[model samples]
Target: MMGEFRDFVARGNVLDLAVGVIIGAAFGKIVTSLTEDLIMPVIGFVTGGVNFTNKFVLLGAVPESYTGSQTDYAALKAAGVPMLGYGAFVTAVISFVLMAFVIFQIVRAANKMAPAKPAEAPAPAGPSEVDLLTEIRDALKKA
Candidate 1:
């Protein structure tokens, strides 16, 4: 069992999966940062300084107005307030589209960089032993 587990861990597939998971986590953080820190802010500025994330209608009574990013959508639920999170949805959609585009571009580049398979080897060229023997016999008979 221990040996089996060791073999499993040593397998390239397992290591590849682990690497993929780690890379995915890192990519998620990068995308989130891009959306939150740079892209969203620029988008907000472009569209008349409108912050889509803050646009929501509270279903329950909140003593004060909500001031938070789309990440705080869960907070409204925790506060027992039902709200239309269109802005959050919009932000999520934009982030998803951006991330998808980045992934596609990366995949395209990787495809271009991938090494092509080598061509198959040509078949050997040699007469059969029987034919050679026959030829040898014919030559011997003629001589």
Candidate 2:
């Protein structure tokens, strides 16, 4: 059982999967940073400093005993107020689209840089085996 486990772990596919997972985790961090730090700020500046993450709709009554601010999503949730966080959802959608676009561009550029497959040599120009055999049979018949 230990040997079988070792053999499974030692497979090339397992190693590739591990590497892919590590790279994917790092890539996720990069995408998050790109969205939160660079893209969001620029978008906000262009759109008159509107933050999408704060857009929400209150669904439930605000309890009188609630001490936290009403407008804050986290605070409202903590205070047991049901709310729809549309801003956060929009922000997430934007992030996903941006990440997908970036990955697409990366893949496109990589494909362009990758070496092209060598063209297959054309088949030798000659009579095929069946044709040769037919000719031989015809010659034997003539003889």
Per-residue lDDT tens digits for candidate 1, residues 1-143, read: 99999999999999999999999889988987888788888989999998776766666565366554434667776665667778778778887888899999999999989998899999997899999999999999999
The lDDT values for all models are 0.82, 0.87
lDDT of 2 by residue, 1-143 (tens): 99999999999999999998999889888988888788878888899997766679999799999877767887887777888998788778888998799889999999999999999999889998999999999999999
TM-score of each: 0.68, 0.76
Error of 1 at 64 (Å): 11
Instruction: Give stretches of model 1 more than 4 Å off.
Output: 59-75, 118-143
Best by TM-score: 2
Worst 10 residues of 1 by lDDT: 62-71
CA-RMSD of model 1:
7.0
For residue 94, what is the lDDT in candidate 1? Answer: 80
